[model samples]
Target: MSGAANPALLLGASLSAMAAALHLAIIVGGAPWYRCFGAGEGMAKLAQAGHWWPALLTLGIAFVLLVAAAYALGAGGWSAALRGLPGLRWVLLGITAVYLLRGLAPWPAMLLQPELRQPFWIWSTLICAGYGGVHALGLAQAWSRL
Candidate 1:
């Protein structure tokens, strides 16, 4: 990797890390948080009942976000060891795609289930788009090194 730091990737990493933290916080905040975060009433009820599934599911998402953050840090030249990870390019591409696709999730959902639309969908879509854009720019900037 180059000696220069990639600002885009750094921001992307921060965003991902923040998202992971939010997921953890939601788990700690219980049923109300789950409902407020648009995880659905079912998830909120499960959380209220102290079922393992809600926390487990949220934890899995948090872990993935953390992994994505690590990859962004590595790709941004902030971590030498992570930069050397096998299939880094492919993994980064996959991450970027996932974020972008999630950003577009509202479009299909709006068409298929307009009744389910909420403010969370709009805000989350924008956030995901911003994250995806940053990752895309960072990946492009560091393509040759990877």
Candidate 2:
């Protein structure tokens, strides 16, 4: 099936793209934004100290999101880099599983002292499930055609 005709692939790609953009925004938002997102005062203080951990950590997360986006796009046969790889189906599955695990596995640890990230955790879990499921479905369809 054509990439555009595949709803699963499209949804996966869209989610990945959205995640990547959000991560990039976090990087751009710097310390205040990070702190606002529940990163803690230590991180904010570090940012004020010119440590750049806020940006660096966000960059790492952004890199992962970018990789996920590439994987999603590749699910649709849109990337030459992914097209030639061996065991691509397994790779896609692995990526999907990672996303699912990240969102579903994190505990209800307090973001700061007594406050838990209830809403963020809930939303993140759902988003990751959606992303993982979409990619899995798309990869399965693509593999079937192969």
Stretches of candidate 2 above 4 Å error? 1-5, 107-117
Q: Which ten residues in a row have the lowest lDDT in candidate 1?
A: 109-118
Residue-level lDDT for 130 in candidate 2: 73
Query: Best-fitting candidate, measured by lDDT?
Result: 1
Every model: Cα RMSD to truth? 1.4, 3.7
The segments of candidate 1 whose C-alpha lies over 4 angstroms from its true place after superposition are 111-113
TM-scores for the candidates: 0.94, 0.75
Residue 44: error of model 2 in Å?
3.0
The lDDT for every candidate, in the order shown, is: 0.92, 0.70
For 12-108, candidate 2 gives per-residue lDDT tens digits of 8778878778767866776786676656778877876778677788778778777666666666777656555555567778887887776666644
lDDT of 1 by residue, 11-100 (tens): 999999999999999999999999999999999999999999999999999999999999999999988878887788889999999999
Which pairs of residues have clashing backbones in candidate 2? none
Per-prediction backbone clash count: 0, 0
lDDT of 2 at 137: 84
